[model samples]
Target: MSFATPPGWYPDAGAPGTERWWDGTAWTAHTRPPAVVQHEPVRQPYAPQSFGPPVPLPPARGGGRTRVLAITLSGLLVLGAATTAFLLLGPDDSGTRTAPAPTTSDPAPTAPATASASATPSGEGGPDGDPAVLVDQLNGITLAVPDGWEKAKNTPDDAPTIRTAVSYDCPGTAASFCYRGTVSTRTARAGRTDPKAVAEADITAAADRAYEEDILGQRTHGGITSHKVLKAEPVAVAGRTGYLVRWQVVTAKGPGGVVQSVAFPSEAGIGTPVIVRLAFDADRPELPVSLMDTITRSIRPIGDSATSGGVGASIGP
Candidate 1:
């Protein structure tokens, strides 16, 4: 006996265990065979799943609502990516915004004509040995003092005196006169420096007092403390040399004590020569600067008449 089958034929000969006939395509006569039973297959229980956050579903395969949803989701993702990129890569305006220019430390150098003077014979500058040679070589303008003119100490401090001139004392007309000289040093002028400034100051200070006394008080009508330079200036003195200097600023002590000081800088040379004139009388203060004209006229340079860089200082090492 043998079993044979045709193409596309099914084995569904019968539902229960029994002999059956087949027409190759369908089952036919059934014959009782043996008693049997069927049971369902056993399966394991499924465990719960875990995830971080809810995620949207993707479109199903083929066309319809699923396809439309897939296209819409893809477009939304692309749009979001573009927006993020634009925000991060945009140009920055903060760096290029300019601020005001910074301020300057000093004013531009002054015009040469107004500050500088003509040149004077150097003679050489202050003394290493010969007093005359020393005097001749001094900076600022040069002034010749009489061979044996009286001299006075302007300051007790022993600070080296600068530009100056020696002459007879003015306090008295006696046989032995007072020793006095107009001394000065190069110093910053009105925001600058001038060699001749000290002499100008000394003259101006005295002139100012004289003018004031003529108008307001008497020569002996004292009441001012003192006068000093408010600012220094560079100017030609006796003609040549450069000078750096300060000025005469008047100080009034209540009404009785007065000191009259005038300063003029000579050109700056090896030493800072200057001319300083002072009139101080604490006990019996002088009311006016009577010697203003005389002092101004008395100034004389020791060397060349041409003035130059007298204010340029070449002082202590």
Candidate 2:
């Protein structure tokens, strides 16, 4: 290595560990070998040096996604707690309420006004006594039972029934043999507005379809059809409403041999009339039509109108 000193090169004191390279513009003694500071090429900031536009910032108040999720869960928990409290305090009303117990001091229900008034006992009617008179009083009205009739008690525990069966064998053609009585007061479902109308309807029914269509089929209608109205009166008895219909029923049993039908009285309740029903085969023309007439025509409202509102056996052919 021959030493050749250029004009601009000299021994370096400041750059002790470096070499000098000069292209002679001025005296160059020391030079830092182009300080190859080989730092990993300093990377520029990852942002555009000149931002073209500003970035929009996210909302800062409500919360981030995770905070929102936490809040929603908390709300649901509160709702569940409220629902549990309501269920704990709510009343159950799915069952029927029990009836209140009756107090011991409650007054006992008494018989109806008509019933109490019409509670007549059985007795004997005279030879001309129309047995159905008491039945009339029991039905819906009070009436005279032809001077000698008496009323008998009945069996059914509810309705008012009085049998006016004759104690003595009545003349087969007697008019007032029996006073079958029937009555119904205000119940869960029955009523009579114009008691007279109810009475008329009942009589028509008995003398017409109820008796004729049901048992007579074509039996001779004797009681009402044959009789002309003699008198009618309003009456009340035994807490019931009723009337008394009096008339003479003409019955013709044989040709030119008509027997004068006796006048008997019948009584029934307005709501339920004493209907006398009789049945006989078409061939049995000799049925006790008189008895039937007596039973039906005799029906009258027995005792009362202030408040409100029979049976048989087989005749061996």
Candidate 3:
């Protein structure tokens, strides 16, 4: 009989009750006696032993192709499990996956810019928390409103004016109020360009306006009777050289008043002349003769630089 098998022990045909080694392709001389068995005796008749075909013997050790195949399949299952774990977890090596940080597409918010306060304009007028100041927006100047004086209400349409706090019935007409002291300002009229000439020319008109009659032809101070010059000289007003004319006047009825006309170049306007007319009742002993000088010195250009001291010749009583 012929057989094809790997190198191992097998049953030998030529040997009885024994086994021999077949080295893969051929029979070998190596042999071993059958292993002795210890068992209970059988009660049946014995029969002759007959060998039919060569049978492979069991392996002497535990290692074989079956064991190797089992190892390979186990290795493949472990590898599959490891690959599944890798797919489930993130790249962190500590076996725990880490989450990604939050992100935003919008830009970061920024703070709003702060705004600053604007400066007051030159041509604007209002009380600067000082009740004694008179702001004149037209001429861009401020006057020190003297004690016992206030801004005049119902002023004539001809000019901006201020007057004494006290008023009484007009001597000639009881229908109106008359102030003992007044100061008015106006832009110089055309053809009266020179300061000295304008002052000289307007003195009489100023006196007439104060003591002669009102715009409605009503005698305010009983009409002027005579007048005399008190002061006529060049003086510095609001940082500009100017001329002033003061007159003491006599009236038809009540004691007459002192009137003055001051002309100067406007500090803010296009070098145009400005006129300031002042009047005070001569009968009032409370009004000082030097009050005109105080008023003239107190005139200042309006705005932040208004506090600067006036530097030049000044008017006196």
Candidate 4:
């Protein structure tokens, strides 16, 4: 290939402040300073010529050879340094590097803190003294009911119910006057945050849906007398804020009642508030008068007796 540098003494490519001879070919051990020009007949520097193997020049004198040796050592040192510098500072083959651009996005949602795992049971007991402990995994709650009261599973198709219990054992046995009950829990389909409001809304919706049959005289338990709200107040259940709704109803059996108790979960693990209702029909003589009170007082979140937190779902009161 063609070459730029011709046969002449030029500054050493490897060593500064020194010149190296290139006899129309390869670098030679013959080196000198720029001020020390060879004593050859001065002529124009050799022009580019046919490139081939390097043609060695005659050896230099004692002093000249020593200078060449010295320059060669220094040249090696400088050359090494240059190579290292190139590796560190040289531009990349493509171009310079740059950091990526800043980005903007919505923050990710943080999970709710884990609640205590033990459930704390609180409430008054029944005549037997040993209240019935009821744990509901679906709704994430536990409560005490009148001991021996049977838990039934007779949820309607259209109505939302997580649990059901009766005041008496009615597996298949039917009686005119029996205390039938239900536990309903619901989360707002649209993600309502206010627990108490949602719970009251649930109560209103329930009444609107079944007021005629369940509350009014449209349906009969022997014969419906009068159904009216007797108590409505704020109460805490399972360490959550909620409301207590009591409706007194008169039927053929005697003076019975329906209770709607709702509460919010500590951690909205399911991303919504919860409403729980414990409705009892105590018109039946067989059902104890204190059954409703027993269950309501003993209500708690399902877990160890120390933790209080409820799960999410929808059910009827």
Over the stretch 116-159, how does candidate 2's per-residue lDDT look in tens digits?
Answer: 22133223121113333333322223322222223435432333
lDDT of 3 by residue, 68-177 (tens): 75687679778866666666665677857755544333353332211000112233333433456665544546677776787765676646577888899877778888
Pairs of colliding residues, candidate 3: none
- Candidate achieving higher TM-score, 1 or 3: 3
Tens-digit lDDT string for candidate 4 (183-246): 5554444457676677667665543322223433233344445667766777766666666666
TM-score of each: 0.26, 0.25, 0.57, 0.41
Go through the candidates in order and give each one's C-alpha lDDT: 0.32, 0.30, 0.64, 0.45
Off by over 4 Å in 3: 1-129, 304-317
Candidate 3 has its poorest 10 consecutive residues by lDDT at 111-120
Sorted by TM-score (best first), the order is 3, 4, 1, 2
Query: Which one wins by lDDT: 2 or 4?
Result: 4
Best by TM-score: 3
Q: Give the TM-score of candidate 4.
A: 0.41
The candidate 4 region of ten consecutive residues with least summed lDDT is 112-121
In model 1, the Cα lDDT at residue 177 comes to 27
Q: What's the lDDT for candidate 1?
A: 0.32
